[model samples]
Each structure stands twice: as structure tokens, then as C-alpha cells.
Target: MDDSKGKFGFFADARRLRSFLRQSWRSADASMRRGAVVMWCVGLMFTIFGVVGDVLETWWSSMPFLTNLLTSLTAFFFAVPVALLVLHDVSHRMTDRAGRRAAMAVLAQSMYRLEASVSALGPVEHSRHSPTGGPPLTTGSILEAARARFGRLQDLEGGNAEDIREATETLRTAIAQWKLDRLPDQFIEEVGRVDIEIARLRDAVRPRFLQSDLEWPLDRQLHSLAEMANDLIKRPEQWTIESYNEWCDVAERFSQDFDQKSEITLLEINAVFDLLRHVQAMHIRRTTFVQALHDFNLSARTALWELSSL
Candidate 1:
């Protein structure tokens, strides 16, 4: 913190400060930087005229008016431009720097927020249910986890190094996964209720006024979709991202094809089309949201990998 300089330190510090300011201004816009040059030129002009007027006072004792005119010109330039230059630099450039700092701060906060949100979507470092386990925790934590998991000394079952390592890793993952607290149980219950309602509706959703032409095909697609939905009810764990994508594709295509080929414009059949349209909208929204998540997830992963490599 000490800023006190030794002998000859004033010149050294001044040169260093000047160099720092020079480097800082190098990145400034060319047009904006011309202001500094103009200010320097104005000040230089005033200095030159002031020195000439003083020298002329000695040479032209009879021409005092001419000498005084040069002095007056020097003062005139200083009185106007010097004050304006100082005011402009302080008011404009300082304000610009402050504004940029504020904008950059907000931008940085937004980027951090996006990063955190994306990172949260990835698997937890330690989760019992997560297929991808996290990195190692503390020193000898893996060994401690294996020790905690052991039922009895005989349960070791003459394990090889690979088996021991695998068992240790599984326990460690569980221990680490504890970091993530479960969301409220009410949300889980609500999700289950919604799934049941969806299955029930899907099961009952079929067109009564089916013709052999386009209606039959639409009916078949609807039945297939219902089956897929019911399967998820039975085993939600069986579904993957690809499975959801395929489901969305099937639902979207069914909706589109029905719109194109469906000639049934009867008052009663209008209700069916309305229901299908609503379902189509829901599917479209879900598909869009899922796709955005997928794209962002991929981009985040690529960015992380590249950064880690560096």
C-alpha cells in the first residue's frame, strides 16, 4: 500500500503512469481518440503564441501593440477551448466509462445465471439414481464409502481389485449424491396424478364416427399414441430423450395429416378436430421447449469441454 517513492522516483512513476495511460487509450475508437490530439494541439498552440509574445516584447519595444495582440490570442484560445476540453472529457468520457462498466456488470451477471441454469440441468455429482456419477470427493473417501457399505468381513467374497474399486465407486456416488436435496414430495405426487389423468384420457380418446378411409388411419395413430402413453404410466423409467422426441414426432404428424386429409366438417366431428388441435398445440409447445433445452445443453457441454481442454 505504500506509495512513497525514493530519490528519482517521481520521474520513474510519471513515465510509468504515462505508459499505462498510453496503453489504455490504444484500444479507444480512432475517431474518439482524435479529441485528445485536438486538445493537445490547442494547448500546444497557446503555449507557442504565449512564448512568442514574451520574446517579441523584448525585440519590438516600439511595437507593443503587436506583442500584446499575440498574448491576447494565446489567452483567447485558452479561455474558451481549454475549459471546454476539460468539461467535455470529464462529462463525456468519464460518463462513457462508467456506463460501459455498469452494462458489462449486468451482462456478466446474466451470463453467470445462464451458466448456472445450464449446469443444474446436468447430472448431480453424486446421485444414487443418476447413471453418471461425480468426481472424487475427499481424501480416501472412496475407501471410506466401501468400508461403510460392507455388511460383514465375509461379504467381501474374495473380491478382486476391479470389483473392490467398482463397489467403492458406487457407495461414493451415493454419498456425494446426498448433496442434492429432493424437491418437495407434493410435486412428485402431483406429477403422478397428472400422469394417471393423461393415461385415462388417452385410453378413452377415440373417434366414434370412423369411416374406412382417413378416419381409420387417424384412429390407428391415436391408438398407438395411447399405447405409448400407457406404457409410460406403467414404466416411466423406460422412456428416454429419443423416446420423447419420437412421441412428439408421431403426435405432430398425426395432427398435421388429419388437418390436411380430414374432410369431415360435420358439426359433431368439429369437436373432435378441436380436441386434436388443442392436443397439437400442447405437443408443439412441449416439443419446442424440449428442443431448446437440448440445444442449449449441447452448446454448454461443447463450451465446457473446449474450455477444459485449454
Candidate 2:
């Protein structure tokens, strides 16, 4: 029985290894295809150079025989249909890559927006319309509604509320110290609005907590996102493919970090704050980003299509 188990484990390991290799090969093939397209485009430029050089030599010199030989060689072997093939391959690959990247960027943007919106719902009390028959909602009523909507208050019962409040306050202090008062009016207004909301929520929840120590993990994440946004805003012209890729990387890291640290029960709390509205906003942003990319892809496709038709 021991020997049989050992054999089974060995076969399982072997199968896993084989599967890994197959995947690696497929990835390698795709990379090679992309590289090949680039190289083919470069080769076509060289072919054009060779043809032009031959033609110029023929016109400038009196050597008919040599000129004819060179022209014939370049035209037959280097110039004609090969350049068209290269152009087709390069354009096709570029379109495919652009479409893929655009999709990914949109996905990243949506997640980032969702995270921001969720962070906005930090144990806050606000006047809201009451579902049951009563007077117009008060801040206290809103808090109760939020608490009730987010079931299993056990997580929020402990130090979680304090942690959130502290982290938010720390973020606000940092932003204030950064002396961003001179920033664009719109940016200052947005930041001020968020800050006011944070302060209101903190004041509402402070009585229940013993201490308000900053949550290091959450603070770090907020700081990182703020820094990235600042950098991008400061130098929008520096936004390149690489910059966009970095944005995606940061957004993904933020998502993963938030997931690892956040309690699963928090999703319930999130539900209380009209989470669907936030998600809907994120979906709209995502759709807009995707549409922009789709338009770019269509433009690329049209160019290729015209070339192919010709």
C-alpha cells in the first residue's frame, strides 16, 4: 500500500509538471509571435532602404547593367509583397494588444473607484429618507439604519470602528500638512468634501471607542493611492504605456491588500451604505474607459482592414 501511494504521488507530480510546461510553451509562442511582428516591420523598412538605394544609384550613375541587376534583386527578393505581410502582422498584433490592455485598465479603474467609495462609508451618520413612516431622517436614525443594514455587528463592535476612524483622521492630517490648499479649485473641493465626511463619521463613532490608534495597513494603502494620483496629476504628460501599466499594478496591489486585510463580514456593512450605488458608479466609469479603448481598437482595425482590402 505504501508503494502504491508513492507511485500515485509521483504520477500526480509528473502530471502537474507536464501541465506547467504546456502553459509555459503557449506563453512563449505568443511572445515570439509579437516579437516576430516587430522584427518583420523593421525588416520591411530595411527592404525599402535597399530598393531606394538601388534606384538612386541607377539614376545617379551611368552603369546600366549594375543598376538593373541591383534593382531586379531588390524588387524580386526584398521589396514587393513581404513589406505588406510585415505591415499586416504588426498592425494586427498592435490592435490585439491595445484591446487587451484597454480592457485591463478599465477593470483596474473600476476596482479602484469601488475601493474609494467603500472607504467613504466609515461609520458615518447622515440624514436619509426613512423607509417606514416617520419624520424626515435624523443623523442618529441614519446610524441605526446603517448598523441594522450591516448585519453581524460583531466585527464593528470591537475596535474596528476606532481603527477606521483613526486611519481616516491620519490621512486627513497628512493631506492638510501637504499644503494642497493652492491646488485646483475642483480638487480642493473634492478633498474638502471627503474630509468633512470623515470628520463627521469620526465624531459620531468616537464615543464608543477606547482609543483611536491609526490602522497602519489601511493608512499605508490610502497614502500609496494618494501619492500615485498626485504624481499622475502633477505630470499628466508623463502618462505613457508604462505609466498606465504602473497604475494597473498599483490598483491590483491595492485590491489584493484590501482583500487580505478586510473582514468578510464588512461586505454586510458595505451593503448598508447603498453599496449598489457605488458599484453602479464604478460600472459607469469602467464602461466609459472600455468605450474609449474600444474606439481606439476600432480605429486600428479600420486601418488594418483598409490595408487588407487594398
For residues 63-136, what per-residue lDDT tens digits would candidate 1 score against the true structure? 77876776676566545543454455456556655554443343344335444433443322222332345653
All candidates: TM-score: 0.28, 0.20
Q: Which 10 residues in a row give candidate 1 its minimum summed lDDT?
A: 208-217
Overlapping backbone residue pairs in candidate 1 total 1
Candidate 2, residue 100: lDDT: 46
Candidate 2: global Cα-lDDT? 0.40
**Global lDDT of each candidate:** 0.41, 0.40
Instruction: Please count the clashing residue pairs in each candidate, in the order shown.
Output: 1, 0
- Ten consecutive residues with minimal summed lDDT in candidate 2? 207-216
TM-score of 2: 0.20
RMSD after CA superposition, every candidate: 22.7, 25.4
Q: Per-residue lDDT tens digits of candidate 2, residues 71-151?
A: 565455444334444455566556656654443344334334433543432222224444577776543333333333233
